[model samples]
Target: MAHDHQHNHLVQMLDLDAEVLEDFHRELVGWAGSLVGDRPRVVDLGAGTGTGTLALARHLPGAQLTAVDVDDEMLEHLRHRAADAGLQDRIRTVRADLDGDWPALGPADLVWASASMHHLADPARTLARIRDTLRPGGAFMITELDGFPRFLPDPGLEDRCAAEMDRLRREGGMHMHENWGARLTAAGFDLAGERTFELEIPAPLPPAARRYAQVTFARMRERLADRLSADDLAALDDAAATAAHRDDLTVRATRMVWVGRRPS
Candidate 1:
């Protein structure tokens, strides 16, 4: 039983069963697969709803995953999800504040910090801590958006919306951009190259994916209602309305993955 706020956010990005994250899971697992051992011990920071955890379970089969989040409700749901996937014994959850000192995490083989890294009070420090938590030769990966998805068809609408979104996120104490490779280096991890996942689901996306996109845009519009101009807002509404009806919609985003490894 998740609290309303936690429940709503998770529902926005994931379906009741975490099925909507299949593509998300695939992208992440694909990048980490070569690095993870058959029985690797892994930790996911900011493991919201455990979407990535579920991905790891399916891919690594034998991976021991520790999912840490500040929200107990999310962790609770993650537990249920793992059980449903018949992976309960392989997944563990920790309620934690990633900004403060980390909890008893790992000598883990892999550290997966997705959209959560930039949310940290000091991302560089956290990255360093992540390195220390990993076993020698352990791997680290941070997946974050370069920007929001471009949904508005109108010229300039995407820019205005993205700018405002940045303001709102900064106000929420989130840092939306960082040279993560540099941060990882500063944190004492050796760089292992990076990749950008261009997420474009040709439309008539499965019902869940479509719903996820709809929720994403709707939430954006709501967040920017106060900051966006009437004209811009109206344009956004038009885009949203059009998106809702059409199957040829373009749900596009760039997710950058920075990989690193602690010296063995």
Candidate 2:
């Protein structure tokens, strides 16, 4: 039950990300579509909530997408979202752990991994596997976040929270900061393109953004319960409680994307 509850929060968070950052998502999907053929066979690694899968499907009507994730619950949620979007025909969900033996997902023309590669136990090996999964000259796109988005107007509290989160992630062995472009080259993929997006949505945020801020604060509060100082935890609690009602909130985030290609 606890796991399910956590998954629910994750689902809401991912979906809200797509919703609140609709422009960025659309631009990303368009850019990804530009790298492939009209009838490209795409694979979305760690496809949580089917955001990329469904977006790619809708953007490229002729594309076929396979959304793969280790969590059965995530896959189930993706399937349901695809069905709701009327993209079930073009999108299929596969449950497989990328850290272990990968299932046959290839000869794909394009493989997309968004904010998911950093979680792999061995990213280099996974990159090699992804190279093999794609056909010659096929493209692989990777997206990674610097950290969670910050919604506070004053940067002090959020900065402290981010530092604590970084410490926690580092101690927990997460690869949050990696030179992925160089890694792709070392993995024998030609670095095709790299871009970093800096997003800032100002005050008068939509209702969805407000809820997103609330959820993010709440999650941070829970995760940093023991890590943050007493005063910081209390501030987080107050922020989470009043986030939805705050008019001064702004969303700031940075995302980096790297594209690599299998040499023909």
Q: Count the backbone clashes (under 3 Å) in each candidate.
A: 0, 0
Q: Please give the TM-score that candidate 2 achieves against the real structure.
A: 0.97
Candidate 2, poorest ten consecutive residues by summed lDDT: 1-10
Looking at model 1, residue 248 earns an lDDT score of 65
lDDT of 1 by residue, 131-197 (tens): 8899999999888886656643443878877888888888888877888888888888899978777
- State the local distance difference test value for candidate 2: 0.91
C-alpha RMSD in Å of predicted model 2 compared with the true structure: 1.0
Q: Estimate each model's TM-score.
A: 0.88, 0.97
List pairs with backbone clashes in candidate 2: none
Error of 1 at 11 (Å): 3.5
lDDT of 2 by residue, 1-264 (tens): 755656677788899999999999999999999999889999999999889999999999999999999998889888988888898999888899999989999999999999899888888889999999999999999999999899988899899989998999888778898999999999999999999999989997889999999888877877788888899989988988898787999999899999999999
What C-alpha lDDT do the candidate models reach, one value each?
A: 0.78, 0.91
